[model samples]
Target: MRRVLTALLLTSLLPLIAQAQSYSHTPPGHTGLGGMIGNPSGLSLKVYGTDPASFTAYDFLLAYDLDRFFFFSLHGLYERPLPDSPLNYFLGPGALLGVREGSSHANEMVLGLSANLGINFFTERFEVFLQVTPRLHLIPETEGDIGGGIGLRYYFGSQ
Candidate 1:
């Protein structure tokens, strides 16, 4: 029975594996649109730009969170490409602004400083990423929270 199940699973996954192998890791350009799912997660949009001196891409992220209440953030990240690989790691600073509500409490505007880190996998015009971000709230109260998510984005330029 185990052998039968394993064979069936592999057979089903063959097409997906083949497709993944056919995709190239070269990025087409600098901008993309996508969405993320996880703690305090929502829509994610990212842009990549090159620094003239290092000729490496830096990442900027804008994301909106709609869990329990609505909130948004903007982040600037320095990205490092892993040598001889299509994966890159990024970390940086950001700011978060949002409003929170509770049945017994008044609506409060939340503000914080945030740190973000993530790894990205690139295939042609697409990226798959995983990220963890921590925020230190400094306004309307003081608190901290850590959140992470997985995301996918499609580049807007040529492949």
Candidate 2:
């Protein structure tokens, strides 16, 4: 009986998946702008590779650390589309530079290396994404930590 129910559920969803229309979220050479909310959350920008067939991208971000400090990051990412869905997964490594604020700690710069993993949901002209990043501090000290955020981007080109 359990097997029959499982099969029925899958069968019902198969037609929906097959009939779905998918639009490319970020085609090559297109740029996206948006913002995020979470650890070091702020303005976000991304540009897909210039090659039409390439799945690579560049990401730039300016974010704040919960009112404590501001940071900037630039990453090289590769996006993979999930078959039969309007979802994409991306991962990459990047560098981060942050400046502390408030009190004598202000104006201190910290450098780190970051690895990011994220998923994106594409609509006709907008993309929503959530990402988690692990950072390893190298300068000013050595420490490892993880952070994540939710963000949305608007595409400014053809789908």
Give me the candidate number with maximum lDDT: 2
lDDT of 2 by residue, 5-28 (tens): 535754664554455454545667
Global lDDT scores for all candidate models: 0.68, 0.78
Location of the lowest summed lDDT over 10 successive residues in candidate 1: 20-29
RMSD of each: 6.7, 8.6
Angstrom error at residue 129, model 1: 0.2
lDDT of 1: 0.68
TM per candidate comes to: 0.74, 0.79
Question: For model 1, how does the per-residue alpha-carbon lDDT over 1-159 read when each residue is reduced to its tens digit?
Answer: 533653575466445444663332334236878877666557777766555444234444445444455677878776767776656787888888887875666787888999889877666677777789999988888988887777777888776
lDDT of 2: 0.78
TM-score of candidate 2 against the unseen true structure: 0.79
